[model samples]
Target: MAGIKALISLSFGGAVGLMFLMLGCALPVYDEYWPLFVLFFYVLSPIPYCVSRRVTDDTDATSNACKELAVFLTTGIVVSAFGLPVIFARVHVIAWGACALVVTGNIVIFATILGFFLVFGSSDDFSWQQW
Candidate 1:
């Protein structure tokens, strides 16, 4: 499960990065807005590594994974919140509204990650009986 998460996260991150880079070079009007995507990419960048560690059987790996997950989610929320106004002010209405799509996607991702963490943490043996 975590491996799948890691792969998806990395793929999404890479696509976002490449898209921003291309946008920065190809579109002068959107250059300033490109940085917004760059920052968002960075905020989401740790998810792959965190999810990779998350599925490990080792205690240390699990601890680090939890920490990384917490950091990624926390930073993501903070970055998005701060960037929202800036994004709204700088981009066109249509482009700015696209942020809602971004936000909804990110929220789903974070919820999945956090739910797994919570479920694992609450269980003694990671069994369904705990639920």
Candidate 2:
């Protein structure tokens, strides 16, 4: 089914992104765990949106304050995820190569997250809530 296929691809993408994050932290040439802090950002990024979705009703209006605030918070979390690695690299806590790897991982992971919302954030038969 199309839903199954989308789930598989999204899972694969998330795995690949985590692999890159692990490499950035565990590679012998760049064995620094500072980049691991980005995992916190990853965990926090979706919370705002999920909370807002639960708290607000879907409306036909052009805009909604709760949803806008949720998006703002999500953007801050994502920016923090990207910025943390750069700060670590700048402070020499992690190598530039490691920062680059972490950034790439962030990109892939965020894209996968976005893809998930796009594919599942609908009032259709294939809603992710069923899982």
Candidate 3:
């Protein structure tokens, strides 16, 4: 089924994204684990939207304030994720190369997360909660 294929590809992309994140920590030239903190941003990015979906009514579907606020929060979370690496690099906690790697990983991971929402979310037919 298309869903199965989509799942496999998304999994592959996530794996590659994680591999990049690990490399930022594992590679010798810029060896440090502090950059891994971006994982928190990655994890927290979707929470607001999920909560907003539960709180707002879909039927009445006029411009909802809660959903907009959730989007604003999500944007802040994503920007923070991107900013974390730059901060680490600026503070000399991690090398620029490591920061670059982490940034790339963040992009890939975030894209995968978006893809997941597009495919498995926004549809009553497929619910990620079951997984």
- Compared to the true structure, candidate 3 yields what TM-score? 0.93
lDDT of 1 by residue, 1-131 (tens): 76456546655755664453455434544334433443554456445545544565565443565556657766766567446634664655325434444454444444444554454544465532344
Which candidate wins on TM-score?
Answer: 2
Q: List model 3 lDDT by residue over 1-131, tens digit each.
A: 88889999999999999999999999988889998899999899999988987887674777889999999999999999999999999999999999999999999999999999888885576678566
User: If both were scored by lDDT, which would come out higher, candidate 1 or candidate 2?
Assistant: 2
| lDDT winner, 2 or 3 | 2
lDDT (Cα atoms) of all candidates against the true structure: 0.50, 0.92, 0.91
Please provide, for model 2 over 9-50, each residue's C-alpha lDDT reduced to its tens digit, 9 standing for 90 to 100. 999999999999999999999988888889898889888988
**Cα RMSD (angstroms) for every candidate in the order listed:** 9.3, 0.9, 1.4
Residue pairs in collision within model 1 = none
Model 1 ranges with Cα > 4 A deviation = 1-78, 81-89, 92-94, 127-131
Candidate 3 wrongly placed segments (more than 4 Å):
59-62, 129-131
The C-alpha stretches of model 2 lying farther than 4 A from their native spots are: none
